[model samples]
Target: MREEENIIVGISIGDLNGIGSEVVLKMFEDPRMLEFCTPVIFASIKTMSFVKNHFKLETQLHSINALDQIAPNKLNVLNCWKENVSIQFGKEDLKIGEYAIKSLSEATAALKDKTIDVLVTAPINKHNIQSDTFKFPGHTDYLNQELEGNSLMFMVTDTLRVGLLTDHVPVKDVASHITEELITSKIETVYQSLIQDFKISKPKIAVLGINPHTGDNGVIGSEDDTVMRPALQKIKESGKLVFGPYAADSFFGSNNYKSFDAVIASYHDQGLIPFKTLSFGQGVNYTAGLNRVRTSPDHGTAYEIAGKGVADLGSFEEAVFTAITIFKNRTEYNTLTKNSLAVSKRKRFNPKN
Candidate 1:
C-alpha cells in the first residue's frame, strides 16, 4: 500500500462543454485538499488552462505527459490529448463527448494497472458520450467491465447510504431485470461494501419494494412477494442482518432509513430520487463491489450553470474525500484478512513452532 499522502487519485474530466471542469477546479482551489491525496487530471493542460481562465480561478496546474511525472501537493494535469478543443458552455457537442471518454478510459486503465490508487470522475453527459468504443449506459457500466466485481451503484453521504438493485434501466424493464440471482448478488455486494469500504462490522440493510407498499400484499404487484421477499428470506437465513422490501413512499419521509446501515432501492429513481432529496444534492455516487475505488458527484453536468462560476462544489469535494477514505479502508481490510488467513494456516501446520 502507498503512503496516505502519496495515494494518487486519478480524475476524469467529463463533458468539456459542461460544468465538469468548473467543479473540479473549484474543489482543488483550497491548498488543504492536496494534503489529503494527490490529484492527477487525465486531460490536457491547454483545455484546463482555458477553463481556469474562464472561471478566473487562482488554482495553479502542473502539466505532465506520464503517470511517473505526477507531482505531489499540486494539481497535475496529464495531457491525454493535445489538439485544441473548442469550448462552449451549456452546449451539447458530440466532439466534446469523445474527449470525455478519452479521459475516462485513460483513468480507468491507470486504476487497473495500479498506477492510480483511486479514481474520482467528473460528471459526463450520457446521451452525447455514445460511440463505437463506449456503449455503456454510464460510468458504473463501463467500470463494471474494465474492473472486477459485481459493481453496484452505491450513492452515499455521511449519514445516509443507498444502493440500487437496478441502475440505468428503464421503468418498463426494471422488473424484468430484477431476478432472484440479481437480488441476491446486489444485496451481497452492498453488505460486503459496507464492511470493506465503510468499515461497518454488522451492516444493517433495508430493501425498497418494487411496487408501492411492497405491492400491497400482491394487490398492486406480485413480483415483490414472489421474487424479492423470497430472496431476502434466503439471505436472512444465512445470518446476514438484511431486511425490507419496505414501502418506498413513506420511508424517507418518516426518517425510517436512519435505522439501517444502507438502503437498497428496487431501481434507480426509487433510490436516487430520495437520496438526492434527503441528501440535499450533496451525495457522492460510489461504484461499490469493484476491485478498485471510484466515486463521482451525484449531480449531472449542470449545463445551465456551466461556466457561470457558481457551481456548488460540495459534492465533488465529498467525492474526493470519500474516494481517499474508502481506498484506505479497503487497503486495511484486505491486509488484515490476509494476515488472519496466514496466522490460521501457521497454527494448523505447527501449533507450537
Candidate 2:
C-alpha cells in the first residue's frame, strides 16, 4: 500500500442538492481510492451523513476540523460549513448555494496552503450559486480570481485535449471577448499548462478561427484575418509551436487534431462541440493556470439521474485520476529542473586540474 503522507487529495462537495454528494459517496466506497491518496472532503458531517444514509452506501466518514487531522484508510471530512439548514435531494435551493461556495472556498484555501496535493471538485449549478457574495459563473471563474494570471478551461480525453478561449459567454459577446490580447494570452496559458501540468514538453497548439473557412480571408469577417492571424504571428515569432487560424468547420473533419497536443477555440461552442462529439461522457474538465490543481467531470449535475444510483461514475473517476497524475508529474518535473540547474552550477564552478 502507498504511504498516506505521499498523496493527499482534497474534495469539494458541490451543490448539496445535486448528484455531487451521491458521486462522492459512491467514489469513497471504492477501497482503491485510499490506495492513491488520503481523500479529504470539505463538507459538513451532517451533509455527508445524509448522503451516506440516503444512498445506503457502506463508507466510513471521519470528521476533522482541520486538514492536518486527515488519516489514512478513513474518509476524512473537514467540516467547513455548519449543518444549520435542511437539504432536499434533487431540489435546487438558494440556501445550499452558500454552503456549496463555502466548501469550495475552504478547499481552495487548503490547496493554496499546500495542505492538499490535488483537488477533485464535484459539479456545481451556476444558476443557484450566482449571487452577491459568489458572483462568479462557476468554478473556473472563481479559481481565476483566486490565482494570479489568466486561466483557461480545458476539456480532456485520453486522445484529445481542447481548450476554450472564451467560456460561459453568450454567442453575441464571444466576438467582443476574443480580442488579440485575450486570444494570445489564452493560447499561451494553454500551451504552458499542457507542458507543465500534462508533461507535454514542446507542446503543439492549434488555434481555431472564429469564422467559417477562416473568415474566407476577410470576406465573412475580419476578426480571423485581422485579430487571430496577428496573434498567431506574434506567438510564432516567440518560437512557440503554435499554428493556425484554421477554419473551425474543417479542423476536426480531417482528424488533424491528433497531431497537436491541444486545440484552442475562439468560443465555448466552437471548442466543446467537437470535444463532446469525441469525448462525450468520458472527458474531464480542468481549470488551468491556478496555483492548485482542480479538475471535475466534464458533464453537469445530471439532475434527472441525481439519486438513481445509475449516474455513470466514469467521468468522476477520470477527473480524480487526472488530478493525481498531474500532481505527481508536476512534482517530478520540478525536482528534475532543480537537479539539472544544480548540476550546471557545479560544472561551471569546478576548477580544471
Candidate 3:
C-alpha cells in the first residue's frame, strides 16, 4: 500500500471575492505542510495571482496544467477552468460565484476519478452560487447529491466535536423535520463516523433537545420528549452508547458537551453557535458518512476580511490535516475489516527458499 505521505490533497477555491484565497494561500505558504501531502488546488492561475498580489502574499502559486505534471513536495495549482476569471476581491458578483462553482465542479470530478485522495474545500457564498446545475443549500447538500450517500454536517476541533441532525434547513422547518426516524438515522451516522472515520472504538454520542430547556417538560414544545428521547432510547437499547434529549441552552455553557465523543444538535445554529464560540470559529467542518473524505473550515466566506492578508489560516490548515487523517484512518480501518479474510487465507510462500 502507498503511504499517506504522498496523498494528493484536492482543494476547491471558493468565492473569488472572499477570504478563501487568503486562507488557502496562507496554508500553502508553510514549507513544512508540504511534507504531509501534495496539494492540488482546483483554482485558476489568474485568480490566484490577483489574490497573491492584492494581499502581498509571499507564498508561491505553482500552477500545474494537468495531473500528470504533479510536482512532488510542492503546492500545485490546477487550472479548473479553460476561460479566464476576473476576480473582484470583497465584492459580491455573479461571475465570481460562477467561477467558484467551476473550481468546485472540477475538484469534484477529480475526487471522483481518484486523482486526489481527499478534498478540502474553501468557503463559498451560499447565495451567489445558486444556479441551474447547482441547486443545493451548501457543500454538504451538494456532496450528498453527487455522492449518493447519507451525510452528516459534523464540526470537529481538537477536543470538541458537534454534528447537526438537521442541516441547511429553515428555522421554521427544523422542528417539523426532526422526526423519530430521522433523529435515529442522523445520530446513527454520527456514531459510525466517530467510530470508523475518527477511530473512536466505543463512541459516546450525545443529542441536544430541540426546544429550550428540553421543551420545558412539554411546555414550550414536545419534540424533544416525543421525538428525540424515543429515538435515543431505541438506539441505546440496540447496544449503542447514545444518550441525550438534554436542553440545548445549558449544554455547552455548562460544559456538558465535553462529556461525549460527539454531540448531535437538532438543527444547524443550535450546534454551530456554541461550537464556533468555543472553538473560536476555527473548527473543521467534516462531511461524514460519505465514501470519500471531504472537509472545510468552519467559518464562511468572510467578505469583510477578504484580501486583507489577515484571514486566519488555522481552521483551513486544520481542515486539511483532518481530511488527511480521516482518509488514512478510514483506509486503515477498511483494510483491517474488509481484507482480513483475504489476508488471513494467504500465508507467505517459501517453497523456493
Cα lDDT computed for each candidate against the true fold: 0.94, 0.85, 0.86
Alpha-carbon shift of residue 326 in model 3 (angstroms): 0.8
lDDT per residue (tens digit) for residues 91-206 in model 1: 99999999999999999999999999999999999999999888999999999999998899999999999999999998999999999999999999999999999999999999
Global CA lDDT computed for model 1 = 0.94
**Best of the candidates, TM-score:** 1
Q: RMSD, each candidate, Å? A: 0.8, 2.2, 3.3
The candidate, 1 or 2, that scores higher on lDDT is 1
Kindly report which residue stretches of model 2 are placed more than 4 angstroms away from their true locations once superposed: 1-5, 347-353
For residue 79, what is the lDDT in candidate 1?
A: 99
Instruction: Residues 1-353, candidate 2: write the lDDT tens digits.
Output: 12324678889988887788888879879887788778899997887988888889998899998777888878899988665558776788888887888899999888877788788899988888888788898999898888666778999987899999899999988888888889878888898788778889899999998888888977988888888898899989999999998888888989999999999988899998899889868899998876668899887777777877777878888898888887777777777899999988888898451
TM-score for each model: 0.99, 0.94, 0.94
* C-alpha lDDT of candidate 2 relative to the true structure: 0.85
lDDT of 3 by residue, 131-150 (tens): 99888789998888777569
Model 1 spans with C-alpha error above 4 angstroms = none
Candidate 1 lDDT for residue 78:
98
Weakest ten-residue segment in model 1 by summed lDDT: 1-10
